[model samples]
Target: MSGIYIHIPFCKQACHYCDFHFSTSLKKKDQLVFALAKELQLRKDEFKDTTIETIYFGGGTPSVLSTNELQYLIDSVYLNYKVTDHPEITLEANPDDLIINNIDALSISEVQSLYKTKFEELKKTGINRLSIGVQSFHEKDLKLMNRAHNAIEAKRCLETATQYFDNISLDLIYGIPNSTNQEWLENIQTALSFGIPHISSYALTVEPKTALASFIKKGIIDNVDDDLAHDQFHILIDQLNQAGFEHYELSNFAKKGYYSKNNSAYWLGKSYLGIGPSAHSFNGKQRAWNVKNNTIYIKKINQDQLPLEIEILTKNDKYNEFIMTGLRTIWGVSLTEVKKQFGESFLEYLLQQANQYINNQMLCIVDNRLKTTQKGKFLSDGIASDLFKLR
Candidate 1:
């Protein structure tokens, strides 16, 4: 259940809300690509005994790279590591990159006809799944977020992508300022129309130093209403559940047999290697992350050095992470496993800390596993922190 995550640290333009490490320039594209392959080769021994089951291309925008560049990286993975026969290879794409023809003038049928070639080229590169970032279907929402594509382009991309890839996922953001409840519902319904097997929806939080945060601070845009976000979160859960999608994690919903293997491995605490700038990796006992600066990452890798920092997890660190990730998903924390792994003292501390929430009916024990009640799902993070064994 191990995986590899490759970060593509480039984008055509910056999204207003994004604070991730990436540059708008393609000047270093070639060097970065070569460095990525070199890094994979250098780190092969780390996963010598592990079989890679998933290869994920995540980013600033992985689709910004050409099919050839993507194929080069995939080839590097096969050359360096042992991959499973049916590894789930995913590419996070934007609608603008997926649609070759002008979406504004073309009909859905016409766009699909023109778009087949691009998707076919992508599929030939061994990419079996596509996670498209179609944040909203309304022009206003797109404009507010400064997304790369319009509402039409989003719909057109999905209309065509569905024909080529069965295992497709789309992203949607809830809790935008000035967005009404009805508008939020419309966004959900429109995404469901695409018939995507998996959906990763998130509440839009204004991170510090991001344009969105600055705008709210200066009155350029209204601040995100917490009450509105809370309402929309419930709206999302109810709508998706009725549509026959499993609310597998706090923010991800999927049809049966379509859960994201890469992400599931992450939550279950499986070992994985993170390649590329700003990517994080985890084994059961330790976690590491690459340098955020692309130039430094490339230079270090070219010099046969890993520009990364490692953190050896203490027993409490592992326990806290398990509780946080565990409570966020349907597969809750196993009390027996906790005692077995972290010992009776750690397990006792966890149960003592969790008793308050359990009494409030926000958390409960089912088959000896600690899980969040529906009433507490939206507050899982807060509850998990409360249950943490802080020193």
Candidate 2:
């Protein structure tokens, strides 16, 4: 089965640590939405024979769009492609966009009714899942990251979201500078308190051009401590496991039967089409990405042209990707599949490189599948890089 990823490249404001391509201005929103639809029609033949099992609305902040605008884009997909019945449709939202304002005069039940009305409208758009970006539940952390939503909005959103959507996922950031392990633990507990089924957490890495990186460079903010991050990651795993969530991937924990189908398709190397600026697509043997500029993207699409670059994957490139994605999940690299797809030499080379990690108890072959040990889960990416067959 395949999937389609729609990139909504607009946000209300910039976050301190984000480097994703987006515009804070909404002046071009209408034109860009139309362009996205046209591009889907223009590329219908690419996935003509593939049944799309997941439709993901990802972005700078997909919640920035109105329900009608979102439905328009979803309708565009149905018009051009063969989507499976009951496909998993996910919209990535920010807490501020999802919550309702509390007017002092309005009763608590009246405010809740407004929230219900809002999310019900979203449900009508065929979005069955909501991935809310609740990076932290701490007020200071929100300011440090320049996230648009405050701590109150984060908690308020989840309180109502869980009442409406069954398949919900929330994001958390573990390694914020100066954040104590206790604070990190509190974040995890706050998320669990909402009964959210899936959680995707990551370290707060300083991307090169983002504001966080510059702040650290100027000594305005301290750099993220790797040692502290390591401690918190383990704390996260322990807390979630005790709560009966599966640590299915490096940064994702899910209750049984609640894993993200869209993201899992990506890790499994299934073909998918990424629509909009700065989105990436992979069709097993090849990969493509659109230009990162919104104006240029709309201009090109209006002219019935694809403003994207494509690359045909070399064998080593495919093998390296498989190894990288494989090691990060509970499902490890398959020795037999490697031999079947890449020949004996590549398999032999992989085993040869992996032998060192295996000897150190960081990796082990169970049922002929090479997987990282619990001790090595945090280092899977570094280990996978060592196993890559460089040309």
Candidate 3:
């Protein structure tokens, strides 16, 4: 099944480690929403034959928008696309927007009590799932990361969110400098305590030109500890598995029936349309990405021209993508798929490359699918890179 990803390119404030496209100013917020609706209408024919099973509202910070604004966009999707009867509509939001202010300072939080009203409102608007960005549950860590919400808001949001929605996911960050193994475990423990069915965790990466990167360059911040992150990754794996969660993807864990449909579809290479600035779209053979500049994107959309770059995927490109994505998921890379799509030469090339990893117990051929072992899970990307077909 296909999906629709509408990027709400606005944020209340910037996070230090973030590099996603967003505008702090909402001066053009109304115009941007209208443009997004128009873009949906324009791109509807791109996937005319496919039925949309998921609508993911990812963003600079979707919670920054009003509930009515979110509903307006959902209505636009319904009006323009062939969505399924019960689509999994998700909103990516930060904890602060979902909870009352300064919930972390007080011993008792009324933030959760206030959440009932917001959750009910969102439920009425057809948002079936929430992906809360609860990066950490430690106040010091929150401040270090320049997060708008504190530790208590992170916990408070989930305490209430779980009451209203069962299909929820939380995002956590690991590998921040000085965050010890004990601290990271505590973060995991705190996350599990919230009873969230799904979690998407990632190591703290220093993206070029980001505030974190700049801070590091200026010696204001220490670089990420790779060894510590490695340790924490394994800890996360063991803990989540012990807690009965499936290590479905490299960065995601979920209980049965709670995996993210939008992300799953993407990993499976299913078609999806991405609307808004700096968003990317893929339709199997070709990929398109909208312009990063908000003003440029708006101007082009206003003139009925899509301001984006397109790339036609060659055989090598497609095969490499399949390898990268396939290796990350439990599904693994299929030998049959390689032979069927890319010929014997490529299949042989893959098998020959995978042999080393397989021999080392880092990868193995189970039912003809080349899957990674627990030892290779943390190093999956590097292993996958070594197996890439050079074009």
Candidate 4:
């Protein structure tokens, strides 16, 4: 089975730490939507033989689109691709879009009631899942991140959203500057109290050129604490494990029945088609990404050309990826599969590289599969890189 990821590269406002390809302007929204539909049609042949099991609307903020506008693209996917009877359709939304927040104009009950109404309308549009961007519930932290939603919308949206959707995932951020371990614990508790089935939490990294980086450089904001982040990560793991959410992957936790199919497909190396600006698509042998600039992407698509460049994976590239992704999740890298797929040479090289870590107890093998041990989970990426084969 395959999946489709449609990127909506527009946001109501820019988050200070975000470097994702997006614009705060909505002037070209309609044209971009039209172009995305056209792009889908153009790339239909790529997935003609596969049944699409998931369709993810990820972005700057998918909630900016009206139900009808969103549906037009979903309809396009159905019209073009072979789809399963039940497909997981997810929309990534910010709290502000999900709830109409004029707490003064309406009572808390009235405001939350409106959220239910809006979410109900969204549900009817065939979206089976909602991924809420509730970065933080503290007003100070929210202001620090420059997230559009305030503390009220964050809590209010969850309280109301749970009423409409069962397959909900909340995105939370840890390690924000000035956020203490206590505050982080409270955030995790607040999320658990919502009874959300899935959470995709991440550390606050300052990517180059983002406002967070600039702020740190200029001494406007305090730098993030690595020790604090380490402490908070354990707090999350302990609390979530106690709450029965599986730490299925790094930065992700899910209840037994609530794993993210869209994300799981990516980690498991399943084929997926990505449409719109800055979206990436991968067939087994090759990968492609759309142009990052909206104007260029629209222009190229309008001219009947795909704006993305392509990369054909070498055997080494594929092998390295398998090891990296495998080690990140609960599923470890299978030496048996490696030997079968890439031959004994690659497998031997992997075992040779892994010997040191395995001896150190940072990793262990189960049934010939390599996975990170508890002490190594936080540094899985670095470990994975060290084991990469040089061609």
Candidate 5:
């Protein structure tokens, strides 16, 4: 089965640490939506024979779109592609946008479209899943992160969404400056108390050009310590493990049978299509990414040309990608799959490098699969890089 990811590139405000492709302004949203619809039609051949099992609307904030806007886009995909009967459709939303009582003013009719629309009517649009961005449950941390919603709103929105949707996932950020290990544990427990079936939590990283980066440079905000992040990551893993969650991907945890099918397909190297600015698509042998600039994306798409760049993966490229993605999850790398897919010579090369790691107890062999030890999980990125095959 295949998957589709559509990025909505608008946000009410920018988060201090976020580097995602989102605009604080909404000037081009109407044109951008139309452009994305056109792009979906143009790329229909990309997923030709594959049945789409997941359709994710991720972004600056997908909930920002009105029900009619979202339906128009979803309708385009169904008209052009063969999708599963009960595909998992998810929208990345911010808590502030979800309070049912506040949508009257924020409704899509604000666009005063050639046609009228209302954002509050989204539930009727067949969008089956909601992934809310509830970064912290503490007001102090919310202020530090400059999130649009307070701690009360964060929890309140979850309660509200539960009334309409069952497939809900909450996004949480850990390792914020001045947040002690105990506080982090409390955060994990708070999330578990919500009884949401899925979670996608990540360690806070200070990317370049973000306000966090500049504040740290100016001594106004303390930088994130890798050691602290590592320590808290351990706390996170242990707490979630005890709560009966599966550490499926590196940062994602899910209850039994509730793992994110869309993300799992990504790590498994399944073919998928992505539409919108800064979106990426993969087809096993080649990868493509749309332009990161919103203005340029709209301009190019208006001309009936996709603003994307493509790369054909070489054998070495494919091999390195496998090691990097494979080792991060609970599923270890399989030697049999490697030997069959990458050839005997390459398999031999892998064994030679892996021997040292196995002997050092950083990795172990179980059922002919090469898996990481507890000590190896934190340094997984470094190990995966060492095992790369150079061209």
Candidate 6:
């Protein structure tokens, strides 16, 4: 099944470690939404009647938009695309936005609880799922990362959310310099305690040009230790497994039935359309991405041209992509499918390279499906790259 992704390219504020495309300015908000609607209509024929099973509103922060803005955006997609009867529509939001105003809203918050009202409105307008960015539950960690939400807000938001929506996913980051093993375990425990069904966790990396990277260069912040990160990665996997969560992808875990349909579709190589600034789309044979600059993206779409770059996948490119995404998931590459799709030579190349890994106990073949051993999971990307065919 295919999906749609709409990038809301604005945030209330920037987190120190974030490098995603977003602007703190709201001046172009209305124009950007209108432009996204226009882009959606213009590209309607790209997928050409494919039934969309999921529509994800990813971002800077979709929750920053008012109900009216969100409603209009969803309506526009419905008007333009043929959506499935029960599509999974997810919105990525932060915790701070869900809380009532810092003051006396607590009395009102205790009355009907504003978080509940917000979820009701969100669901009424077609948001069926939420991917909340609850990066940490430790006050010190939250402050170090410059996150807007406090630890209490993170806990409250999820606890309150169970009253309305059950299809919720969360994000967690590990291996921060200050996070100890015990602290990381507590973080995962806290998340599990919330009963969230799906979780996507990642090791904190200091991307160049981000504030965290500059702090390290200035000696104001310590650089991340690879060994510590690796230690914590194993800890995360073990903890999740013990908790009965399936380690579905290299960085994602889920309860049996709560795997992310949108993300799963991506790993399985299904087609999806991405709308709005800095979004990427892949339709099996080609990939396209919109401009990262919000102003430029809005201007181009307002003038009736999609601000995107297209790449037609070569045979090698396609094969490498399959290997890269396939090897990361629990569902590894199928030798039979590879042979049928790519031909005997490429399949032979895979089998040849896989021999060493197989012999070394890093890769295993069960019923013609090649999967990574538990030890190889952490180094999956490197192994996949080693097996890739050269042009």
- How accurate locally is residue 331 in candidate 2, as Cα lDDT from 0 to 100? 93
Steric collisions counted per model: 0, 0, 0, 0, 0, 0
What TM-score would every model get versus the actual structure? 0.97, 0.99, 0.96, 0.98, 0.93, 0.97
Give lDDT tens digits, candidate 1, residues 231-321. 9999999999999999999999999999999999988889999999999989888999999999999999999999999999998899999
C-alpha RMSD (angstroms) for model 5: 4.2
- Model 3: per-residue Cα lDDT over 84-126, one tens digit each: 9999999999988887674566544465456667889999999
| lDDT by candidate, in order shown | 0.93, 0.95, 0.91, 0.92, 0.86, 0.89
In model 2, pairs of residues that clash are none
lDDT of 4 by residue, 212-329 (tens): 9999999999999888887888889999999999999988999997999999998999999999999999998999999999999999999999999999999999998899899999
Cand. 4 TM to true fold:
0.98
- The runs of at least 3 residues in candidate 3 whose Cα sits more than 4 Å from the true structure, single-residue gaps closed, are 102-114
Top candidate on lDDT is 2
For model 4 the local lDDT of residue 234 reads 83
Clashing pairs in 4: none
RMSD in Å for all candidates: 1.5, 0.8, 2.1, 1.3, 4.2, 1.4
Q: Model 2: per-residue lDDT, tens digit, 1-391?
A: 8999999999999999999999999999999999999999999999999899999999989999999999999999999999999999999999999988655789988897898899999999999999999999999999999999999989988988999999999999988999999999999999999999999999999999999999999999999999999999999999999999999899999999999999999888899999999999999999999999999999999999999999999999999999999999989999999999999999999999999999999999999999999889999999999999999
Backbone clashes in model 4: 0
**Residue 109 accuracy (lDDT) in model 4:** 83
RMSD of 1: 1.5
Worst lDDT run of 10 residues, candidate 3, spans 105-114
List, residue by residue over 1-391, the lDDT tens digit for candidate 6: 6998999999988888999899999999999999988998999998775988998999899889988899998998889888889999998989887666564545754746566677789889999898999998999888878888999889878877767889999999988987899999999999999889898999888987888888889999888988888888999999999989999999999999999999999999999999999899999889999999988998898789989999999999999999999999999999998999999999999999989999998899888988999988888899999999987
**Is 3 or 5 the stronger prediction by lDDT?**
3
